[model samples]
Target: MSDFRSQLQEKLGLSSVDYHSNLSKEALFQEALTYDKGRIREGGPDDEHKAYQTRLGVQGPLVFYTDPSCTGRPVKDTFAAAWPEFEDKIWWKPDFQKYDPEAYLGLRKRVVEHLNAKNARLYVQEVYCGVDPEYAIPVRFVGEYASHALFTHNMFPKDVEGVRDEDEKRWTILNVPSFHCEPERDGSKSERAVILDFKDKVVLICGRADYCGVNKKSMFTVFNYLLPEQQELSMHCSANVGKQNDCAILFGLSGTGKTTLSADPNRRLIGDDEHAWTKDGVFNLEDGCYAKLIDLNKEAEPVIAAALSMPGTLIENVPALPGKPLEETDPQDLDLTDRSITENTRFSYPLSANPNVMPGARGPHPQTIVLLTADAFGVLPPVSILTRREVMYHFVSGFTSKLAGTEVGITEPVAAFSACFGAPFMAHFPSVYAKLLAEKMEAHHTRCILLNTGWSGGPYGTGKRISIKHTRALLDAALRGDFDEGNVEYEKHPIFGLLMPKSCEGVPSEILNPRNTWEDKDAYDRQALKLKEMFHENFAKKGFGAFGIEDVMA
Candidate 1:
């Protein structure tokens, strides 16, 4: 074992202390959170001696100071239980190592003071996990308002530990320690101590660090927790659910119209990215919407353009000024040059914050499941309705060409398969989610539609990429139930799958067929065969050939 592992084992009281002495910082963080509740409660110091007594009628809001280093291993562990293959890939990777914990804690103190001054109940929780299994420390702070706080720091390697046989395996320890301080009127020592408010019926996840690497994964964890108990609402690439009787789920990968199309002024948004469907109705997971921060122009997406700096919204890694000296200005521009670009985004107001959204909202069973694809090849029709088997086939195929620069070799139509539109965020195996989705769609009579928001004439950079405005127009028409009124015709293709040509008004007629999209017929055939071969190879490796998915592709 390494020195770091030894320190963690000694701190955590692990039985296999010698073996874990060399574990990474992240591993120690996970191991410490595995302690039993009794051990954690018995080992922490008492805060009652320094607790501040508040008057009965005082109107103070509850506040929590999360330990910046206290990694939320419970959440990570839960996700791992769902998809054991992704255990090592979870957690945040923000550049938190460069800054000092003391400095960050000081900033948090100021923020807490600012909030407490507004008559909010304030409490602080300090979180620590054992480096080993033996010594787990959990601390809580209870007082009028705690201004400063501190937490232990650790790091570890990124790797998956094991697979889970059932959903019940998802569990992790929660230990958050915080310092509480209330403002003094006469300059006497303001009461300072640790606080724990277990009765508040809330969980405060705090980190002083700027970013945690698990942006998408963390969002999934939050969604997994927020989902309704009985109903199963899985994540997919889709758009916001609007008010009125209208229900349209925009489906597409990143950079497609999923975000832009759903941000319509005409319709109220249910959620931008993820949502849950129960027997009751659909509920949004995030408190806000997360939009991609790319070459964003005000004219292209106006709603996103306006909500750039809304309060409680987070703007992720963007670039900075090239040569100008650093000066105080709009934080929006500073997003330029931020390295956290993979998850660079903006979260909208939480569903709980909006009164107009569903009251006492729970997950909703999907009424219509829309599968979105950005076919850079411009061969797919604008839209097509799918059968249950087709949905399963496409769900596994998850085909769409990567947009230029969005991926390394994104120009051609790349065969990408992500179960239920999000593989990383899934809590169970791909088949588990698929089976549930198929059963739900059958039970609820949910309709699944494939909408291609990509090019219509030639491959990207050759033929014009589908105009975002036109795509939005098509989406609006579909949501209004205009497409169902028309007699749309679909032709089943071998590799490209189903093609819908008659419904959309603006799309070209010839682009509906993959053969017509390319100038050279033979070359297109060769490339198409290559893509099919790639699909076959992937399917064989994943044990799909036996299931006949390989036969369908061939």
Candidate 2:
């Protein structure tokens, strides 16, 4: 064992340790099932292991349950140590809470002590963040739960060429879900905390919340902060390539179809959730894709649905059918409609899960840049071409409608504006990313489009969500150069100034204009005006005055 690993084990009082550093996927899967962290719940009715009950580890193939109180991310309890040099660089806010440097050490000491008290076996997994070795950072996931370590293996690049086994230039995260903190002494907001120290390049913490996403997202936060410094724009988006190597990227927040739209079997997927765009093109930040599993349908999302049955795919918080034997609980049999555990039920698997993925998760410069929005107001057109100014406006505005019950007490479609489509993960100023995107698009002559995968006829309560079939058809048309083929005429929307196409190949000519799709044209006008006002308010609040594209809103 290396000195660093030894010191960490000694510090945490680990009675036994398995250093599964850079293990193959098969070996890691075996260790994960052996460690009793999760179940291998079969996917098909007649697949092997029909007698395998849902007990986990030594117990059986049972589901790992977490406390209901801590289902989602505990942002309030998360913090970043305020080292002197990084204080000015960080965009300090609710999500990026600043912690006292000395106080953080005190917290770490307590965390280490808490781990030592467990006196259990620990698993350590080493992985890489970037697909491009030149920019990739060596990452280590040290945790008490073997499943999370296995997840780390699945979610990040493994077998990176340049990184040696004992290389010390790495970021190490110690994830102990059982460890708790005292707000009074540890300078925390709750028992759960995710603290990042950039100077030391370490993420310390505890998450009894047991939402494994914290483990992946926390590292993404680190990358979001670091990548911009190198002139690479870190984005919360998905990318894919075509037969002619025509690359495209989709940017959106939660509830938007960033993942669903990008998982095109007709095209090669580069990455699903996060990526970094550079001069050489785009490189995936993760080796795997983390897809939401709520109401997942086999026909609508065939690629994602097919991946669920594959070995090594980790399903979190999906409930088994009531009264069914655990052994007979196939993945297909689980109730995706049941969100009693979490609406955030997720599937984590390596890019290998999808047959049509870019090798090393890297692709060439994109020919199209898509900004996906779930506009519940039903005002935005299903598809619209964006100018450079409009692109800047929408990119910074990052507008989307929040679905009811996606969070606590949210029962209606609430308009949300997250700058760059990922404000929480963005570390630098919004302009840093916006400027980079504009420069790249201009340089590459990329076509930009605004796609609304939300409601169409009226607001959420009155109208239905835009059909996935239509959205897919529209996206395919745009990717195949149909939009720019010069046969279609464009008209400007009065409020948003986006150029709406008058006709599309597979879509109805009437639905191309959102106003025509509504029976109540006057009501649509009023709602459009209301949504326009929200956009204006958001632009003013974000201080996009410096961007000089404020006139696009007029």
Candidate 3:
């Protein structure tokens, strides 16, 4: 054990500790079920149990339940300690609260004291974040709960073959959810705080939020900060490989169809979220997929549906049927629509959950790069082919709507533009990643497509969400060169300037033009221009003048 480990052990006052360097799936499941951290719905005996035992049946599948109170990340309560070294590097947004070093140390002492008072045994799990040996980061997860450790096991890559035990670059996350902090003294906005110390490479997650995502993403924020130094472009995207080894990456913010679209049964899934495009190829930063489960239709999303029943998966904040005990609850009995717990209801399952997964979670150079946006304003075309410059423009713009109920107070879709599709996780300026993407796309001759999986015809209330079937059809067309087949005509979108295919084979020709489907052409024009203006304003604020970023003004 290092000095850091010794300090933690002494602070926690543990008589003995269970250090799982890398616990096996079965072992993790056993621990999760044993300590009351999570309840495993077992099979056999009764009808409910019987239903749980079966594979992907109507009753869904058995799941391990986590605490309802912490279904989603506490974004508001999180903070990043402003040490001298990386203070200037941070984006300093509302989400990234600045914590004074003195205050952070004071809070850490209090949190440690509280943990020592609990006298509880802690589970220390060792894991790796990246799949590529050269860029992979070793991580240590220390938590009071076993289920979180299980989550750590399921969500991160475990093959740390070349990483040495003495690797000093490992990030140590201390998750003590029971330790509440004083807002005034801790320099925290709330009682719960997730603080990242860049200089120390340590994360302190204390108080009310126990969502496992906090731990995982804390390291991701670090990666988003560090990877760029190595000239690697880290992205908030999903990736996959086709039969011909042709790779594709889907970039989108939360509530967009990045997860849904990338899980095509025909293609081998490389990863569901968080990836890096290096000189070699695309590599998944995470070993697992964290997917939203609201209104999940097994038939429509067979790949994601299949993962629900996988043994090692961890379901967060999904409610069970009224009278069903967690131990006997069938996944089908659980209400996917229930937001009583949270709309951010999610599950984390390993890449192995998808049968058709790329081994080593890596793929060749991307042949297609997709920008997925749920345009709630419903003015953008369903699909449009983009020039290389257009791709970079949209890439930096990262326009997507904030879906209803995804956040604590948001009850309806709201237009949002997160730079590079994931502003929160990004640690550097958007230009850094944009420049890298542009270089790689040009070098690989990759085709880029803008996919709108949001509303069509009108704005949110008046319009309807584009059918997944249609979106998939459009994606298939782009991937298979169907868009380029025969005599293809392009019409420029008046406001956004994207070239829409005049007609696609499977898609209805009339709807190809968004204006045609709108009941009021004038209203469509107004909404379209409004959204375009929002895009211009966002790009202007980014100040990418040096990168030649321009607004698509008519």
Candidate 4:
């Protein structure tokens, strides 16, 4: 342990610095409770400047807030310092721009100097990113906030072995929420920036990127690039194992019930959010779950709700229950409906919080691959059995929807197509991930399906979101291989040319085909056709069809 500590300090150039490295969760929790302005529940510091005060009698189940203006990810202020040594390997879009390595050097040097000047006590947590010994990489997290260290400790695996050359391959995260950037001086668009430097294997979190997601995702983005180099698939999905040890993987973007549906009481959870599919099997890149908590119904999601009382769990941004102070109220009574802080409220908890979880956060090759989508247009069938080619097509054209009021100007349902269901994090081209997925599917002989948990009768506001009971039933039937045999009747979707089952046990026959549920036949036809064209347009825009992926629907 001492040798590893020395290596970490030397690797991060922190030998002379007074920093705590690889402390226990309990120690970090105490540090955060005192140093990070941790509230008793939601009671913030009176002065805000007294953040450094060590308040005794620290009651836990603590809550913390980011900058009020930037409660969510600062997407605009994110950039990559792609070194000239490796050019064009990373996808450099406008939102994720390329930073000048020279500018980053000056900014980082000054930032470290500033931390030293303030005598800020840094927290370091060294951990692994994945559970699989072959694919997982060691990550040394050096940050200003103790909560970030605890977050990293909660979200990733520790004591992972067989990752050769841990020193050279490991990545470092230099997170300093205290240091705000000057746009002109720091070459940042705003006072804060989240910069990823591939050359140094470091992520710079200047400003209050106290959003715990930045801590987890900064490493995931790197894994997406590194894993594919070894022909492995890094996925943005949720996975779980069943009673008979049957494994299922659910793929989708935000608003899709990947996390919610995977934490089944009957099944054992493997992981939520990030995973890697390798030659051996599938393993969760993260050992913990970072689930959204906006309007969370405790009874409906018992697994997640039950995790609230666990010791290592951390809740972000959810306000205190109405009419009571946090010090007096139970954290489970948190006002999930209150979006006063931000709608993107979250909960970070380790897998131990879940009573039923796959050991080591590892599972076999998935028997069923579910492509989940929340189609706000209500045009997609509840469940569509996909052919192998269709799976390849839809995998790249990863489609979902944005309901009205989700963003600033989206007054109606808007079509959203993310390449591989995760464009921003996919460092390599979409084709890279698509090809790897194809290889895995062929080797494993996996069956794929598209399940819509969005709307039924009509579009959002007019129709209801699909019932969770029905969604779970459909998913259970899929995992059981009910559709594998041709016993259940299926009808061909006219507009999108998908194979929709006519009926299933526990699901209504009328709602199986989305058209029958709608009041107006002509309106349903128009909407379905519009959604079909949107898929084609997305395919063309992404140029996925040219990357050896056929336009199956077209």
Lowest-lDDT window of 10 residues in candidate 2? 44-53
Top model by TM-score, which number? 4
Lowest summed lDDT across 10 adjacent residues in model 4 is found at 49-58
Q: Model 2 has how many clashing residue pairs?
A: 8
Query: Per-residue alpha-carbon lDDT of model 3 for 316-336, expressed as tens digits?
Result: 767666876655655555688
Q: Can you tell me which runs of candidate 2 are displaced by over 4 Å?
A: 1-63, 117-120, 163-168, 324-328, 405-412, 485-487, 546-551
Cα lDDT of model 1 by residue, 1-554, tens digit: 12432332233222221122223323332332232011111234433221111111112101111222222222221212212333333322111011122332343344344433444332222222111111111222222212111111111101112323211222111122232333242111222211111112112223221122233334344344334223465565443455554555655666556766665666556666665555555654334444455556657655555555332233333333455322232444544334332334332222333333433223345566778878766556566667787776667666677754545644555556554566545543445555566777899767777777777556676766766656665666556555552456656775656545454566555554656767877766676567667656766655644444333545
Model 4 TM-score on a 0 to 1 scale: 0.92
- Candidate 1, residue 535: lDDT: 56
**All candidates in order of lDDT, best leading:** 4, 2, 3, 1
Q: TM-scores of the models, in the given order?
A: 0.58, 0.88, 0.87, 0.92
Candidate 3 Cα RMSD (Å):
5.6
* Regions of candidate 4 where Cα sits further than 4 Å from its true position: 1-12, 37-59, 321-325, 406-411
Instruction: Give the clashing residue pairs of candidate 4, or none.
Output: none
Off by over 4 Å in 1: 1-216, 222-231, 242-244, 319-327, 332-365, 403-414, 480-486, 494-499, 544-554
| Model 2 lDDT, residue 117, Cα | 62
Per-residue lDDT over 1-554 for candidate 4, one digit per residue giving the tens place of the 0 to 100 score: 34655674464444445688888877777787577742222355422421211121133444656656556777788888968865578877665788888888888888877876776688888899999878888898888778788889989999997788787888888888778798899888888888887887888988856687887888889899899988789998888999888889999999888878887889998887898888878899987888788988888778778877666667777766677655566676677888887899888888777788888888999889999999999989999999878888888888999865755644599899888888888888888888888788889988899999999999997888999899989999999988775767888998889998877889989999999999999999999989999998888887776778999878
Clashes of each: 72, 8, 1, 0
Global lDDT of model 1: 0.42
Candidate 3 Cα outliers beyond 4 Å, as residue runs: 1-21, 33-69, 116-119, 164-166, 402-413, 461-464, 482-487, 541-548
